[model samples]
Target chain A: MTEQQTGDVPSARPYYQPPSLTGRPQPANLADILERVLDKGIIIAGDIRVNLLDIELLTIKLRLLVVSVDKAEEMGIDWWKHDPMLTVRERGLDEENRELRERLAQLEGTPDDEEGGQDEGDGSARGRQSAGSRSRGDA
Target chain B: MSDMPPAPTSADGPEPSVPVSDTATNSATNPATDTVTDSSTGQGSEQGTGRYLYAVCRRLPPGALQGVHGLSGEPLELVEHGDLVAVVSTVPLASFGEDALRRNLEDLSWLESVVRGHDDVVQAVAAHGPVAPMRLATICFDDDAVRARLRQWAVDLGYVLDRVTGSAEWSVKLLELAPQAEALEEAEAPASGAEYLRRRKAAVEQRAASSASAADVADDIHATLACRAKASRQLPPQDPRLSGLSGTMVLNAAYLVPDVDAAEFTAALDELRGRYPSLLIDARGPWPPYSFAMLGQP
Candidate 1:
């Protein structure tokens, strides 16, 4: 038996891992397990003779459909790259920036140029001064 | 039909009235009747009765699985029609019934356990013969309800079983890339821009060549292994994140090999590993044809 087959030799920790982006209790071997779970499988649902629990309360239906994640990725849903947990992750700096933009927009209705000429001149002058400072700092 | 409890009888005869367990006290009135009231009237107290779902299989071995219980304490019973057997066990209606599933399906742990358990029973039946696993949390009201399903889906379920019979599933994963000294050359700062460009070009070409060689190795490995198997399909590379695996996944393929050649199939994978030092080929299997079996297939 080779070292690989035995799986005994110490190896470096894996970089990419499974079990959802967020740490949750999921099948350790997710890819293999999911191959079976997320396929065109069987579904069973029946009539309820009782009228006690609410429609939202008594009926629990199982919907199983199979689509490969690779297919989903091929569709260019690139959000998984940025957010592996998808919608489940804690909001970070990107969300903060988005919130700030939204708040700014809500407070100040869309900005129309009020002092357009003066704004342009001041912006260019500030840019030149900042460029000079940046070059000096780099040097 | 009038909503009344069926009078207590011990024969295999159909009753027009709703069937209720004898245990329901007058306070509870009739448990089966109470189940319907819970559904329509939106009242609580229909707490404990759950539908016992079973495997949806055609021509399942009769009397094969007896005295089996669901993960919960509900007694397992066979709901059959013609050749199909639904190995079912009752569960708490609040949980296994339709409404609770929609609410709890989003819970990852609950979903995983239920899916795993469903897979486990399917696997057991599949081991004996072609078995069509039910979707996660398929709840049926009673044996008659299960038989109705079998009759309704007999053709689809039969098609699924035919595709999987005389086949087994094997998983082949490519080994991770072992970093080489050439990577270090690229990492080190180049002495000049021209030299830097040259190094970068070489690095790109090297990577391309490496990938090409890995593909070649995978092809060679599959060719040799496929010779000993019935059919082979190369699935797309899996995300390391989804697989919890180390390194890149170069090849994720499932092969359906005849049971007789299973040993030879494994040996072929081992041989490929020995022959190719540039590639890592890992194989595991003889599992139920999970990847290949599908209902309503062409």
Candidate 2:
């Protein structure tokens, strides 16, 4: 076994070496790491049985924590909007009116629906419409 | 899934006879012992030190993890069963126990550190050989229990290692760029209520068209790259808030590419970048094959 000194940092703490020295990319964002370690991997059950349901709920909480309030609002993640643990703030009149109008548009099956229907001819448009509406609902 | 190996025994090992009483005696005598001991009761039967399994790999060079530490700076140890080696460290039952983990996993900072620690070890092991990473916080009561798992799952583990050998996972995300200032200006200041509705409808149509084309571009990009990869998986797009990136993430994908094809794969990515200048193609990796290490999923 050829032992290579992968740690290049001059610090006395060998384990704290910069990740670059090992040729590994810098530590990815918390979301990326959590997604992989929590959601992916070889799940061989061990003696300690952690509740997977709790972990799933925790993942959702982390997702909410990481998302910016404005972006979460844009995505229509309203679970926390009224949660007692999270701040409950009134929506601005303009924002409320916009949501009402968008809901009305969907109900009316207006021009937006027509454009969406026409775009779905190729089968990719419906996904795009939902994704767009989720993020760019005001538009 | 039916053909997959039976899920490894949880809590109940093949040898329930492995003498938990002996472990309790050892923990009492050795203050630093990793045996699970119930803190509240100061007894070993209820709890003792659990071996936190980070990953399993084949032929890890002796001392490859010399200076590396496991979660909570615990010194790592290797438990070998045949050619498979489990990289593990002792975690106290106080925190790593099932109840403790349930609470700790909810704390973002705790989860973040553990996740990073897990990745760091996986990366260190991957530097030597292919590693099959364990999900967060997989623990065995003792080395015997760990070996029981290793013995039972050896075939599947070997299969996973074989599949991931000489390959790495790469993350590729495609984001749609924000609309130009001119486009935003056009939607503002409608001359009349009729014009306002018209502008709103037009804006919605424009967004729909742009998003549709962006989705097409994303698909094309994934297809072009997937051709160069050994295996590919499209994960859900991450939230912009978590990624600290602007614009809509249209595609989030992981590709397992052999080391030999890495250069060509990157070249293809560069070419795609030039072809779709409007989309932000965020590519990162050569990471441990986290996405491809599944035993039966392949």
Candidate 3:
């Protein structure tokens, strides 16, 4: 099995290239193209006035936005300022975690089993609210 | 095996049995003619037909797109305005109509085919010379509207054409793999619940600091890339569902580099790869400057 896998790796790639880059639509990794057109913000001002008697042109947001584009970067509501890569939801989660961490630190300062239990329970509840144990990788 | 004669019924959606009816932007001048579809209840009627603008280029050869087709198999043609030309093709009102669009756009498969068709046409135009690709589904009432819109945005379009004259776009994705945790594993578990929580807190802090370093590495990568390219734009990290890759994406960036400097860019990328072997640096490009085309747009 190991030998076959190794044989497939080097031989599979260069022998048959990724198709002619010019004019050919490679279907496997089209998400790149979709992201370019969708998220890259193309502005089309007017001219498409086909009457919409029923439905409005609706764009569904794939993920929940903790903060909008207006204040996503500014106002520092973004918890993941330490890393610009994190999404709004991920940053929001991190922000909550950071607060909890600080609170946990404070709780540490003053010995209180009851409050600590309460915080632990809260963290567990939040964990449940998020997908699985730690969806930090996803968020 | 790909990108030739797209599935005809792909983006058209289930063909609307009702006769097409909608108002084009140029409803004021040319009233509805019975030849085209215009059977609305009580709306401004301009036979729901329009030219889908694909891209704009300068002085392209006549047969540049000898055998190319637009979204739903309309033969590609050019509408010339002075030396500027807008690559376009006819789109049926019934399908491209606004209500239809609202429905079609939501269908990922339909949207994908349309976007693919649009990109195919733009890529065909870009092959001949520098082309400024328009937004997907940029519609105009007719050849006149296409010319008018091109004329109106001539200066801005000219700027875009010039900006991307000999440049191409490259995508660079940085994915951060989560670090594995190794506990002390002394005998059994912690004694009390608070003790367990305390240990968990320590682990979380360690992970945070580790990820902080990952963030710095990502910044360094972006900075190095930006310095190499003519221009760089930071796109939002894609959802793993969309990206189809493991690990949290640290950076999603597109860089516009001169056609001549592409080799150097790749070499720099390779060096960075050597620097951070653990981090996945997925790079692909020579794409027609989609990220850099909005040169003069506010």
DockQ of each model vs. true complex? 0.14, 0.24, 0.16
- Determine the TM-score of chain B of model 2: 0.81
Query: Clash number for every model?
Result: 30, 7, 0
Better of 1 and 2 by lDDT: 2
- lDDT, model 1, position B224: 81
Candidate 2 DockQ score? 0.24
User: Which candidate wins on lDDT?
Assistant: 2
TM-score of each: 0.57, 0.70, 0.66
Error of 3 at B102 (Å): 1.8
Interface RMSD of each: 11.4, 8.1, 6.9
Q: In candidate 2, which residue ranges exceed 4 Å CA deviation?
A: A1-25, A61-102, A105-139, B1-34, B37-47, B180-205
> Tens digit of lDDT per residue, candidate 3, span B130-208?
9887766677655555666766888888878888888888888887655442332232588864576566555555656
lDDT of 2 by residue, B161-250 (tens): 999899999988887754642265444487754456445544545655676677799889999999999999987656555566556567
Q: Pick the winner on DockQ between candidates 1 and 2.
A: 2
Rank the models by TM-score, top first: 2, 3, 1
For candidate 2 chain B, the 10 contiguous residues with the lowest summed lDDT are: B1-10
lDDT by residue for model 1 (B1-298), tens? 2222112122342321221223222212233544433333222323445444535555445444443335453334445566666666555657755567555565656756766666666666666776666655665444445566677877877777777677777777775463542454537688754455345444434544565667677777777877777677776454454456554455778787777787777767766767875565656666666666555657
**Cα RMSD over interface residues, candidate 1:** 11.4
Point to the candidate with the largest TM-score.
2
